[model samples]
Target chain A: MIERIESFRRRRPRLLEERVTLAHGAGGKASAALVDAVFVEAFRNPLLEPLCDGAVIDLPGGERLVISTDSFVVQPRTFPGGSIGQLAVHGTANDLAVSGAVPQWISAAFVLEEGFPIAELKQIAADMAAAAAETGVQIVTGDTKVVPKGAADGVFVTTTGVGVIPAGRDLSARSVRPGDKVLLSGSMGDHGMAVMLARGDLAIEADIRSDTASVSPLVESLLAAAPSTRWLRDATRGGVGTVCNELAQACGLGVLLDEEKLPVRPMVAGACELLGIDPLYVANEGKIVAVVAAEETEAAIAALRSHPLGADAAEVGEILEEPAQTVVVRTGFGGTRIVDMLVGDPLPRIC
Target chain B: MIERIESFRRRRPRLLEERVTLAHGAGGKASAALVDAVFVEAFRNPLLEPLCDGAVIDLPGGERLVISTDSFVVQPRTFPGGSIGQLAVHGTANDLAVSGAVPQWISAAFVLEEGFPIAELKQIAADMAAAAAETGVQIVTGDTKVVPKGAADGVFVTTTGVGVIPAGRDLSARSVRPGDKVLLSGSMGDHGMAVMLARGDLAIEADIRSDTASVSPLVESLLAAAPSTRWLRDATRGGVGTVCNELAQACGLGVLLDEEKLPVRPMVAGACELLGIDPLYVANEGKIVAVVAAEETEAAIAALRSHPLGADAAEVGEILEEPAQTVVVRTGFGGTRIVDMLVGDPLPRIC
Candidate 1:
């Protein structure tokens, strides 16, 4: 019997058992089956199945787009406030959103270390699906690769997202100029402190939780309200300090932040003090820093302060043409210290 | 001192102490310093120096493109034939190429396991730079995070590549049809087998080296010769078997391969016999499986044969509409066996 492409798919590979391991994540066999059995089955579409390297997405109303990729390797796999799965979704989506893109689709690639818990894998998949639903982006495509037990941490996730930005709404750090106002969506240090608490760093016992969640909606609101918004950045890897330093450098302007105005929860501050960590340099998963033109700053603040995700929004800083390309923190005592990107890994405690 | 965006240089973070540790890769302070000292310093440019969340690249020729992301977490980070560094470049580039795109620029993100040798990282970085340069792509942007020792293996690398395919190049498994010819470029299983050999699994070692090289040039040649080529798949992950099966399913056709025509190296085949692994399922980093129309099969083969990378290329199979979506292998003895994607991890090896 001379068979062709279609004939063989009739005898598609079956999931060997109900347990998950690193190999299943290896972007190979197990990964394919996992996607077939879970993600593809959940999100059915022609674009999802060709399993093309990445989703060749078509933007609604027609416009060229924005794309981003991120990998999540959170230790403890399951965290106090969220799982690695949830973090993967929000973390990547936010990356796209802050870039001023309407987050649409994401490609999730998982690297499962050998012998990982199967239930954990399914749970992660479920979380991924749910997060996708919330973000209005589907897990359009993925790859799995399995390495030997010693090759990886329990699991690492790499996601690439594609989003469309409507024309005429420019969002880049270079757009910031003198008199632009910096707006923070919510409290800082909660996510970092929560991780320390999860690690049981000390008896100080922080009740603060990771603020990880989808921010596309918040970003959408801001972009709509502040059409003149110059830049948007989420405080993630290198936290606020790193992002601000980047912004200043990108715009050739100085970013002056009033330290007392930053929204830091009491418990997070206590944890940071006890741990000797600078909250400014530590990672934050759920917050964003937006630089809006001075004219729209008030309306933008009002719009953000009314949203659930940004009710604690604060006007923490301003862009100045003087002292260009530096982040200067105005101390509570009226003095200023140069705030720079944490050049090295700031908190060696977490991945 | 104040500096213009053009004049501004990223500052080095204050040191905790001498000597890098696992904690440095933890997405904290140390990770930042490592990025500033090494990667940022090495690949400084206007587009990269800002260290934004993701690079806003100018897609050449204004074509809608394909973007793929991959993270390399192979154990032994460095192996006899290659290191995770080169693997990162190859893996991401191949992902884009197989999707029928001209692999272009890449962004690399490293999660360095703390206390790992700096020299090792330097080597990986050099390999990455060399690989990108050779492939006509630039490592336009990158990020580094360090995690303390116990929390990591040696190191893990994540690379995201974006490539542009000419409009109307409808290449996909779904396009394979009856009367199509399936071709294999060079030998199979060298890459995976090399991994096994590197691990010292067998007493009878084959001189078989890892077929770890870029397949984009080969793909370019095949497309140029047979512009109507149906599908081009790198037989990675689940190897040739899975690729055939994928084509079969996508085209709603069956594919039958003549076993004798497959270019399996004798030594690699012998080693597989001793190890009980199917060469069909072992990963092939460098080889590609292409299915093309009946009319230009010889021209496709001729084009492949001309390239050193595709010297051993051969037409191994034919596609038929009957018995849709199945893969059948005609044995040397005139019998046939179904070749399907593996149900689980084949060897649980890293990419």
Candidate 2:
């Protein structure tokens, strides 16, 4: 690793222009490039080679451990239906869950600004505790650091989770096949729309609530029903469209999403329309995109729908052999258009 | 856990003032109270009951896992001899190492402010990679988030580490006995003073460099020489004084430190005198406090001195049976003074 890092340092290829932009955090091309150039290049390792949502480690005891992390810098700390605390817990738990790991322990670290409200902090803690209990995970350890007022936004929470993946359950984007069926575990754009509305940045208002709930239970049901699931990922920062693109690229396959079949709440859809944002590119906290064998699609959907968080689950897409490494959305008007990752963040700090 | 949280909420004792003050994060009385009221009261679990530097879990295969997390919000991203990235890695690794765990995997989550320099980010990542390699730990998985320029100070790195504790090697503050010897790995105040100089906050300037190096090797040496080592901790955010307080409270014992035995660099001592700050309260990223049986004190110090990071290691304090849960410092002028925890953060975001 030292030799690899030294080799890169010797080249010193000007990786970025000068300053980091919002696009760098948009979970798009820019984000990928930043990660590859700065992090992956420096800390190259087999566990991180897959570039999956989480890293899988094999313990000496023949147990597989999956670890994932996320930092929540959502605006308005408290949003409709949930707060940053809930998002922090659910985000990492979902990441591990989607990786075929049974979420177990989580560590939360908070960077708080001085003069923040103690009452609000307590409320956030309560939200985190409730989310952990509901997901059957324990918040085992934590750290808190306070910065002077103005040095940081109200509060930012980073949660890192560890879970155990049962033997024989190997979930990865590389397992995706050309004939795989794509499953959407619930509606799109709910989390982003809800946060945007709560921020009141736009004059438009809607009765939208974030689908901020843990997807672990839903994942358990899906895995039990469709043991041949190829890949799984939560539609987070860059949303379902971005996830499809990542999956397609990872497997060198094409994805075709039927626009008419995409699950989206009416309120979220209306807000996306008003904001001129594609629902497919808006984040959803309590949603997932699963790729399963074509033969198991029905069972997967059935299992997902059996869970409250996935009641709106649907088979929205399928993998195609042609147009490799791309995502095309079939329009309601019988037309098709390529769906690319967002170039820049439409709603900064939405989650 | 749910019932406990509900019971606390029902009381509504107004545990804290409306707003969070710097004291709440000083790792002192206020910080303890805040954690007890907000986090401990909510996420009550067996693993978290000890409230030690890290949480220990028993893996199914008879292996014990220690997990710890810390967020680096240092004022200056780059300080003399080290950077926030190095601190992030060493900080978490030391937490696990002191817990008698062989540091293994670490996950880092970064929160960057928009418009931050990409070159600086690259340097930080490189620093982290070097630190990880030096510490024999792998950077497995990570996440990155960006906030608008003013929303965050610059960059805050949160690292969560996981390690495996060898069989029958239990290290905890609760294990400290009345006849224990407290050994200091090296000098104090170097890290805090170096960061202060980097920030250019005060008119006084000192030629001090942070002792920001991994302490795992030193810990290995000590453990080998003195298998009876009872407790270990890195003197970090709140410094050795704060750690002493916590250790005393956790074990229901008193700690006595000889002022003459305390090691401090000439530059740091001069700076501390100018600023009217006690060196004991200054943070040390690369130093550690090991509590070993009185009979093993000589061997522990000898072993520590064999390592580069612990060249200046010395037995500076001892555990006492009387004055349980208190810390006293013997003055060079033939007097003793209570070394109470700081009421407020003298150096906020010092990491």
lDDT of 1 by residue, A291-320 (tens): 998999888988888789899999999999
lDDT of 2 by residue, A1-351 (tens): 121122223323244547888877877666776776888777876644543434788889998898788899998888888999899899999988988999999998888899888888988999999899888898988888888999999999999999999889988766788889999998999898899889876897788899998999999999999999998989988899988887776677899999999988888888888789999999889999999999999999999999988888999999999798789999999999999866668878877
Candidate 2 displacement at residue A38 in angstroms? 1.8
Going through the candidates in order, what is chain B's TM-score? Answer: 0.81, 0.93
Q: lDDT for every model?
A: 0.67, 0.84
Measured on C-alpha atoms, candidate 1 has an lDDT of 0.67
Evaluated at residue A166, the lDDT of candidate 2 is 89
Per-residue alpha-carbon lDDT of candidate 1 for residues B227-336, written as tens digits (9 for 90 to 100): 99987778876678866765665566788999999888998999889888888878888889889999989999999999998999999999987777678999999999
Q: What share of the true interface contacts does each candidate keep?
A: 0.09, 0.71
Model 2 clash pairs are: none
Grade the docking of candidate 1.
Answer: incorrect
- How accurate locally is residue A113 in candidate 1, as Cα lDDT from 0 to 100? 62
Considering every candidate listed, which one attains the maximal TM-score?
A: 2
